[model samples]
Target: MKHEDEMRRRAGAESIAGGDEAEQLDQDTLIHELRTHQLELEMQNEELQRTELELIEARDRFTDLYDFAPVGYATVSDKGLITQANIMLAEMLGVDRNRLIGQRFSHFIMPQDYDAWYLLIVKLFRLNLRQQTELALKCEDGSICYAQLHCLPVCSAQSNAIRITFADISEYRRIEAEKRQYEEQCRSLFENMLDIYYKTDMDGRIEVVSPSCLAQTGYTQAELLGRRVTEFYIDPAQRDQLLSALLRKGKVNDYELILAHKNKAPRIASATCRLLRDEAGKPVAIEGVLRNITARKQVEEQLRLSETRYRALFEQTSDYVLVMEPRTDAAPVIVDANQAAFEKHGYAADDLIGKPITFIDTNISPEAVAERMRLLQSGDPVYFETKHTCSDGSTFWADAVARYVSIGDSNMIYSVERDATRRKQAEEDQARLLRENRALMRQLMQVQEDERRTLARDLHDELGQLLTGIQTRGEYITMHAIDSEVRIMGEEIVRSTSALFDASHASLLRLRPATLDALGLSAALTELTGERQKQADIVCSMRIDGDIDALDDMRAIAIYRLVQEGLTNAFRHGKADCVNVIIRKLPAHAGRDDQLWIEITDNGKGVHAEADRTPTGMGVIGMRERVHALGGTFMLTHVPEDGVRIEAMLPLDHSEDSGR
Candidate 1:
């Protein structure tokens, strides 16, 4: 303050100066403030420029991510129009990206999924929440797209939209469906298969078994599972064999075993098994299918027993038995033979087997054997009589019965033969004896006829002359004597002589016909037939055609005797009227000799029921012998209503010089 007075005048001058300084200072401060504000403005401009560049880069990255993403992206307006869509979304719809804008999103959705899409969009927009759904989308090409979609509502004050993203799930769905189907098929096969399916651990414990196991093994599935597989085996060693085969070969096919049922009955089974292994190839379990073969096994055993019995019978029988296999290129060959066959053929077993049947058969040819085989194809048994040759070249007859048979898969002919040689020899001996007997009988008959002819000649020549001289002397005495007693005596003597001569003549004719020696057989037959007609009061007709008179005396005598005997039988036994006799000669033809045919037919009573008139009687027997002695055939037919017809055919070439 004191300095204020003294400085008042100085202060005024200082104040002016101070004021100027203050003003200059204030201006400098203001300039500095301006420079700072300008720097801040420049910095703000640089920051804005950098932020714009970053925003542009972010927009480009988002566009690329949205357009090229694996999943499809789309934006839909509240009206369900496709407001925006990415390249992936266009490709998913099989459409161009630019053309996708402003299209109704529901148009691309499958008609079946339209309601679902509508509900999803409504739920998203109304709840302002995210929604998920599966939809089948229709593409521009009209193909379905199985898609899993995720939707988000994009809402603002200006407009409402839904953002959607989807991925193709068709392949995943297909794989899942296939897995379900395969599992179902496996379950059905296990339950319904007829063969038993089983799984067992390495330690022989059953782990899994099918329902069919109960039917085959007579045990329930519950009883089988978790049990030792060897427990059911009748012989435990069989299980060991099965395991060994499975382990060594990794599999076994049709391995047979015997198992015991719960009731202790035997069960025959055939198993096809496989060894199950882990990825590292270590054995883990065994899986198999088992089939019940008990019935089949029983049938096989019965067949075996039957075959054994058949073989025994074949070896022990007395008849020869052979098995032959037929062929197309050659004759049948013997494949097997019984002991009897080898003994009968005089051959060893090795020599006869595999040889052709023709080797032993003397009567068969290869061509004939082939024909027989062809006939056997009809499955009929063939019976035949055949001749067989032995090792010593002797032959024998055999009665053979052959049958076509099938053994296993081979076609065979089985033959049973019996020796018939003795029977054939006996038949031949009998025929020879019959011929000899016939020849001797003919010789005896010829001797008897010769005796009759000699007796007849003696009676006619010697007795006839004596009787005639006596008769003439008696007649002369009667005519010349004068005494009454002498005349009477002469008459009586002449009468007695005449009566004796007539009786002697009648005896000669009865013993042997005089006409037979004088005339031929035809004339003698005529006289005998005429005499029979008069005696029996029957009509007898005769017809003779041949040169029969030229025959030898024996033949002529035979003809005469036959005619006389025939007339006597007709008059006595036949007791009828008309009789016909015919004799004719037939010319030779077709390698036959000239023959004489004789037929005698009579209208008579034929044969009597008493059997005395049978061919065994003396009269019929003599006639048959006479015809047979001359090597002729004789037939006599008797009809009760008609007549009796006798016919004889004699071969002329068969003379007595040739043995009958």
Candidate 2:
């Protein structure tokens, strides 16, 4: 203000001194100019002060933005030293702003990143370009953090520096690493999995296929890409169906269909698919997985065929079939029955189902049924014959076969029954006929024995008397004859009569053995053996185990006849040189009498093979008939290298009672 006052006084004096007319005018003008200039200077000074205040506020705002910003800002010198750092940068380094100044920026970097920082600084200076990199940095506390560094060149009057921005990105980097690892795992699974993974455009054209496509569809991944998905379908329409369903539901699971392999063979596959959408929610592609189901489909088909055949057989078989489920320890409940079972039992299916197994055959006790069920559960099958009562109250014999079967979750019994009523009746009829035949045979044998005895008596008595008289007359004529010729003729007559008597006696003995009738079976066998030995010039032996006298006449006759026939056949047909006969009595069995066993063996040439092949002759047949008539069994066998043997067994008690 003083200077301004002084300058004002001086300007006033100068202007007054020059105050003549022209001078006074100029001085007034100068004073006016000076006053105008003074006012202008004051206005300008106020404008400048206001402008300076605005600049101070702007600088304050700028400083606040740089120091407290979310990111750290710093200036590094050409020598890689920190020249300036914002409060954020200082905080990031866990150091005071003053402490950070003049510190080597590389020192704040991790040791492992030293070369990277050095290279970054060199590149910034050389290219004066902006660059960004991510690296780890060490804080003042020695803790490490990940940061993204963005560096740009800065030029100032004093020196060249690089301005750098640091962003803390540790959490982001951790998340990125995890995401990469997860993607790698998914890629591995997609490539190596057995199932095929694929992506298709909305037009059903394949855009991506995993490596498994080659093994699953017999098509290379390259061959599949860019091809219409329907091209691999056995029925092209199937793709349309799939798309329609997917459009309706937005996803499909286990949609099964047939696909044509590269070889043109059909393969079954199950697909799980979903629609892929863009950020705008518009459908872009279809992503899916396909699994080969050809083997499972084949197995299902086989099972279906097997079930069909089983049903056919079960319904068509003549034998009655039943399926029953066990009810704990109780009798099994009938669950199913075949056509035969329903018809034979005269019951409707509804009536039989749910009924106990014992219900069909009332004769079987509950305990017995339970026992059979136990056996069946143990994997044992039970077979038995019983009388079964039908729904109509009629009874018939049945043969039942039962076994355990498992169907799904339940254990059941499967039974097959056959009607045996006709068979049983036929067997009874056969037994009756056999008994009647035996009775008639016994009577016929008795009558034949009676006739033989009468013939023997007549031949022995009358024929012997007649031959004796003729012999005596011939002897007298020969003794009293006058001429030699007459005597010689009478001698020839006596010789002829003697020969006739001898032949008659031998014939009577053979027709009816008198010793066999009077003495017993043993004597008859002995005499018969002796005769065969002499007549056939062979050795014959007889063995008797029990007392022959104990046997009744009828039984004795049958025995004698059997023995005689056996010996005759052995000698005539077998051409035997030696014969042995044995008769032994066996002990009695329960409900049976003592049995007699007779065996005849011969040491002669065995019967001819051709004769054995031919039907049995009447002689052997007769022997069998006689033994059968006495309720005995007879067997005739040609032993290899041991001639022929005949065996017979007779029940003594049976023979004795029948005769009486």
TM-score of 2: 0.55
TM-score per prediction, in order, is: 0.50, 0.55
Give per-residue CA lDDT, model 2, range 1-660, as digits (tens): 555566567667766786657567666666786787789889999999999999999999999999999999998888878888999888887999999999998887888888888788778878888999988989989888899999999877888988889998978988999999999999899889999999999999899899998888889998988999888888999999999999888999999989998999999999999998889988889999999999999999999999999999999999988898888867888899999889989999889999987787888887887777777888778898778788999989988888897867978888888999998899889877777877877787778778878888988899888888989999999999999999998899899998998788667665688887678778878888888888889888888887866888877877887788777777787888888999898887887788899999997777664544223333777778888877789888887678888899888875444543
Best by TM-score: 2
* Sliding window of 10 residues with minimal summed lDDT for model 2: 609-618
> For each candidate, what is the lDDT?
0.82, 0.85
- Model 1, position 62, has a per-residue lDDT of 96
Candidate 2's error at 117, in angstroms? 38
Candidate number with greatest lDDT: 2
The list of candidate 1 runs beyond 4 A from truth reads 1-310, 318-333, 354-358, 361-387, 395-425, 459-534, 538-571, 574-617, 627-660
For candidate 1, what is the lDDT? 0.82
Residues 307-423 of candidate 1 have per-residue lDDT tens digits of: 999999999999989899887788789999999988988999888899988999957987888788877777888888788999889889988889888768888999999998987
Kindly report which residue pairs in candidate 1 clash with one another: none
